[model samples]
Target: MEEVIENPDRIEIEVTDVTNVIKPFKFTKDTSKSSLTILNQSIENIDIHEIWNNTTLHICADGGANRLYEYGGDKRSEFIPDFIVGDLDSITDEVKDYYKKQGTKIIPQLSQYASDFMKSMSLILLYFNGVEIVDVDEYDGLSKLMNQLNDKHLVNINSYILNGLGGRFDQSIHSINQIHILNQQYPTLKNVFINEQDIVFMIPKGRNLIGYNSISDFYKGNKFPVIGLLPFSPCIISSWGLKWDVRNWKSSMNGKVSSSNGIVSTNGVIIECDEDLVVNIER
Candidate 1:
């Protein structure tokens, strides 16, 4: 059999489109004391509503639905997830009933083999492929559906995952592992993990040109945004469009890991890598 390389075109990722999710805060000389207190204690400000609005498809992982509900508060009615998927472990009955009444697809997979995050990912695959009639009650339903498809049948979609990182220590590591595996299995699938502080995704090997309308599109208010070109494992990288650009730079955990590097590109950064590198940009 002859070898086949799918999607040989240069991958272009735009982290700027979703930057509006983080609202910029501005204070005036006439600002009231109570308004300042509200601004300081606004936990709701970090919510994923803006990201949710920006994405074409939104799937919540198990307890993630509950988090969305609480975050939305009185405006919970305004935002409804397209699909709620998991082992049905953390989602409460009240939360489940709430979305169920609103016609949200609540899928419960009782399999211990796959995490809630993976289950949601499978649903995303099925959604984009237009795979109708998925057995929501079946254990490992999404996994089984995915197993039935070949590489040519698997299409790429820009997926934004909320609440996948910055949780419990072990789970957070698992989230990163899942992101890496997903990239390998589906090269075209653009998976982005929206962490509380930064947005993380993989930069595929080759010369990647990331373009945006302006530098402020990805990093608003800040003149320069902090970014990292992290090799989850050992890898050599060369880059451009940064304050401290390096040519053919070697990187690893024990060696040099580019962290807190400033983005000097008025628009975007370009990187060519020997291996897939984890790219994290401060939001």
Candidate 2:
């Protein structure tokens, strides 16, 4: 995809509203849709209050239950997870008992082939599809049921994962790989990886309008949001409405890349690429 202008040579542009990061709890543009997944790591500065209140479904990935358990402090009682899905390894006895007693479904998926993050995603899909989480098998139950359904019939899920990236080198790479895999196999599953600094996601092939309404509407800060366009695989790219928008440019890890780019458009930015790109925008 190239331009917004109607031309037989260009691919039609798609609009992705990313206003939920700032206004997740409040209804905006006549809709409120998002899901929260907590990975096993430190979530020291994440806005647990806002995200917990806004997201439609919440799940903790094994040890992540412990992070959520401590982050909530006195408010732990108020923000109970809907389900805890993993290999039953990292979650402590105390934290496990806490959420289980709170009526949260504890699904033990003992599959070394799939990471707990993948298990969490499949669990969310099964949950929204109305599958009984407890009744499924433990070894690879989530994937089993998820494969039975067609992609067209699966629900579109906007997932925000806390502590997903910036962990140990291998796990972080696995998280990145999972992002790309989701785009290839489950295109409807829009997943974002978040820490204290970055809101990371995959920008697919063709044109993508990134942002909702105006920048001021969501962010009232003085600085423009810093962003990057990273190509895991070499690709040709073009763009509009960025501080340094490229045209017919080649982006690759071995060649030119777009990093430390700032969003300048008040409305939104347009990105066109021949291949999928990993994007990380400052929140």
| Candidate with best TM-score | 2
TM-score of each: 0.81, 0.87
Model 1, span 90-183: residue lDDT tens: 8889989999999888888889998877777777766776677455556877777776556446665666665456647787788788878988
Candidate 1 least-lDDT 10 residues: 32-41
Task: State the local distance difference test value for candidate 1.
Answer: 0.64
The collision pairs in model 1 are none
TM-score of 1: 0.81
What TM-score, to 2 decimals, does candidate 2 have? Answer: 0.87
Cα lDDT, model 1, residue 241: 69
